[model samples]
Target: MAVPDPRGGPAPAARAGRPRIAIVGPTHPYKGGIAQHTTELAHRLARRGHDVWIESWSAQYPARLYPGQQRVDAPEMEPFPATGYPLSWWRPDGWVRLGRRLRRRADAVVVVVVTPIQAPAYLGILAGLGRAGRRAAGPAVLALCHNVLPHERRRLDEPLIRAVLRRAGAVLVHTDAEATRAAALTAAPVRVAAMAPHLWTAPSRRVHAADAPAAPDRAGEPAGQATGEATSALGGPRRRLLFFGLVRPYKGLDVLLRALAAGPPDVALTVAGEFWGGQEATQALVAELGLADRVELRPGYVDAADVPALFAAADALVLPYRAGTASQNVDLAHLHGLPVVATSVGTLPAAVSDGVDGLLVPPGDPAALAAALRRLYEPGVLTALAAKVRPPDTAGGWERYLDTLLEAIEGQRRVDHR
Candidate 1:
């Protein structure tokens, strides 16, 4: 026999071992990477016979918390089916109410931690889950941290995120480094699960053409056709690099600009993403570095339709992070058949196979990135890397990710029983 969903419709528990799971996070009509990841995870979990409820937000945050544009006109990916919008940022009581409801209904609760600002809401949820009461038992709480802290940290970030982690039964992070950060925050067991492939990897998504071969090794060749950039001062073939996604200070667009300036003057760059701030500063730097003509800046949110043109035009995608974490850009680049040139920060070093898929340099080092740029334009380097570029094992990856998540929840339950 099945059970009743706390909200409505039929629920899980028709089986013996499967648990009723609730994942608290942003889902449609929210947009962005986190939303996509949350939605996909729920769908997959349900497919595996678990009753999964996406306890999404009625109001995720105030404008001050995330200044960037939020929703898309359409769902960024497939909208999750069983989502409930019971919690809002302004309403503290609702958080507790939802927690109490989950405490009664769910066997496990996965708290998706995207930013530190939502810490209070999570704390409220924990309180209602009976963590503060004698009932101190409810759903097994698992904090799934995309990042332990924000990429750009604030003074209160650590303490705030720490509070939520301390309350959880277990914490799950995408990288070992993030696992270490979670361990420091709470006595809760930390488990490292490779970031699941939440990206759209179907054949239909591969609308962009593979990159053309790099220009000849010699200088003074009008190799503009090889890439979509203008010829260099030496009239060498210009290599166009892409800097995709939302532009943030921590992501190192400035360092990449300096790298572009230091590198072969024939190299050109296309920065296609919404900027969080510093657009004027970026423009001034481009002008100061004499990259005004060579750098094409499309300063707004990129629509899905326009993505193909951006990838089609670039020889490779670039990730120059001063600080970092797991990102979908490497896989995004590979999906479009473009290799990546990234700093060996966060999961980039692992995703990007140096000398095989793309090049990697030290974080924040403009000189090293420039050298990698130079080497990329070498006769066969770019083409060779592009040839070796392959889509990530998204199917197997998700299965493994789910296994890791379940094990952590089970392991924590065993620990609690002891």
Candidate 2:
């Protein structure tokens, strides 16, 4: 059963008849937040009696262009279909045709915007859809922005960013910080919504047995002492630390390994997921730090089916990303009620309440990360953190998020009419 979102409430009626919605983004074989968000949003909207369709990519990225494996997660779930819509960089007309078909069918279009790397594909699809349906007056395009700017810093990104934002009728950002940046990017207004609750695998609400053997105490409390509430797998006696997802330089896995090496010898680290450019460098660094024994490297792209076992085995999740706009890893950790240890980069601090839900350290600071690890390593810390950590509110109550979009649409409609 899907868990109820903590922040979910009643939503206002969505037009008279059920509204038709088209969600366009990287889905299925492609993993990560972009894919997950697209899937969850479709699922949510479908449940609400909306005629929903997902225009996922047929060809997302070439092997050379990808940092890790071909796809992020395995195609275990039915949602992970082999192919649906093919994206050809050379054939913009073919893509535009497909987009027009979707636009004709959909009452509204929700485009999931990512980095510049995907700008060409998304921008083309949006254009196609807009041209497809002659909407004298209807729902405008809604761009759900994960990041207003690009990572790795590119001179070309600003122009592309400006173009996409200017093209959209309205925009939705998960955080206020992103909203502020989006405001500056385009004349189209940006609205802020709480991060979607089911961005990753849904949370498990099954309460753990109190006084269960080896049950760890709450954070800021003693070991073997129950906090009266059920503890997550992380709060169990054997603490597991997960560095789940594809490995990237900005993700800072090397710093996490070094922190484990320099800190307590008892704490263990699981370096799961496929590696990118820095894998060799990271492996060498692990050996140099003498963490070969303490660190378990499960290299290669991990399948989504395996995530439960991987996360269940761990005590806490570590996201030492040196630079990031926002991440679903932190949200995934919260879904399991597993405490997180992340650096103060982008919107990380907003998700993790230092000393309340999880610890926050400076990005790229191994020492501070080591210290945070030690804090979590202390038995029962994660249980306490879990009690206080609130999962994001995204469910039947998506209207709150939609309100932000509607406000922009209404405002823009006024302007367009004027």
Candidate 3:
């Protein structure tokens, strides 16, 4: 027998002993890592035997809040089967209605908290669920924080984030540092679960063997398969050291640029992805550094189909984050068989394995980053690091993350009842 979808679409058949889950966040038509993460989470949960649905947003943010392009011409991942866009920034009534609907439909709710701007809408949802709704009577709420707070803080960030987290029965953070931050704001249980691999490609996308002759990038550029500036035994720099993803202030692309100028002269860089702000400043920096000839800037949303080539054409992925919680970038690079050179902040040290898989430098320190870049170009260093690069254990990581999430839901519900 087919269970009726609350929104009038066909729902999965109700199964014995399986929970019905509602994941509230961005999805396809929405771009970037968070959107992909949310969609993949729903798919993984359903694959693991739960009945899942994505309660997505028709209008995620007001133009004033997120000025950049939000939707994409093409999707980067497999879209979830059951999704509804009943929530919108302009509709407070929809928020409350969706909340009450979720109470009737889902066994639990996972609200993907990407920013504090989402707090007001989330509060409205919880309000419709009766503010302090009892878990026995309604679905338990878990605030799955991609960032407990944005790396760049705002004036109302604390109070807004506090409102949502405290109201939530449990909070899930991606790192211990984020848990510490979340604990300061909420009395609810805060659990640390590392992000799973969503951007992971098929096994075929793995880097060709080190000894394999220089492979041509899908775009037809030779992979060079080389390391840095100087012509080594293998030849000269084929891939520019890469700085991919959103260019936000906290991400430290400026620091990376300064490092690039000071590091090996022959080493070039390709900076890709949309800039949250500061495109002019970045352009000016490139001009100021005299790196015009050495840098290639492609500032826009990169499609999912183009990701492998970005990784393919890079000697290493450079993540010079001044601060962070966790990111799928390091794992994404490893899956492509590309090593990383990143800052030692947040969960990066744990993920990058300094001197093993990737090099770690101090956050916000241009000199340190420059030195790491220079070191990366040293003869044979890049190859040695690349050899250690391994694909993230996608299944194991998701299973562990799911286990933590489910346990948090149960544990928080028990606490709420008490």
Give residue 81's error in model 1 in angstroms.
Answer: 0.9
lDDT of 2 by residue, 329-410 (tens): 8766666556788899888998889999889999999999988887875666666776676554444336565556546556
Question: Per-residue CA lDDT of candidate 3, range 40-150, in tens?
Answer: 888777777788888889999999999899998656666777888998999999999988888777677899998898888998888766565433347778999998887
Answer with 2 or 3, whichever has the higher lDDT: 3
Query: What C-alpha lDDT do the candidate models reach, one value each?
Result: 0.80, 0.65, 0.79
* Local error of candidate 1 at residue 113 (angstroms): 1.0
Task: Put down candidate 1 lDDT per residue, 1-418, tens digits, no spaces.
Answer: 2333547443445356777888999987886778878988987787788878788887888988678777766555667667788889999999898888887778889999888889999999999887754334777889999999988788999999988888888899999999888898888889999987776422235321122122223223232344633334324555688899999999999999999999977778889998898899999999999998789898987766676667767788999998888998887777777879999889999999999989999998999999999999888777778778887677788889999999988887676667
| Cα error, candidate 3, residue 236 (Å) | 9.9
TM-score of each: 0.89, 0.78, 0.89
For model 1, what is the alpha-carbon lDDT of residue 263?
Answer: 91
Query: Could you tell me which 10 consecutive residues in candidate 1 have the lowest summed lDDT?
Result: 207-216
Evaluate residue 414 in candidate 1 and report its C-alpha lDDT on the 0 to 100 scale: 75
Query: Which portions of model 1 miss their true places by more than 4 Å?
Result: 1-14, 133-135, 201-238, 416-418
After superposing all C-alphas onto the true structure, candidate 3 shows an RMSD in angstroms of 5.0
TM-score of 3: 0.89
Clashing pairs in 3: none
Off by over 4 Å in 2: 1-19, 72-86, 129-139, 199-239, 379-383, 386-399, 406-418
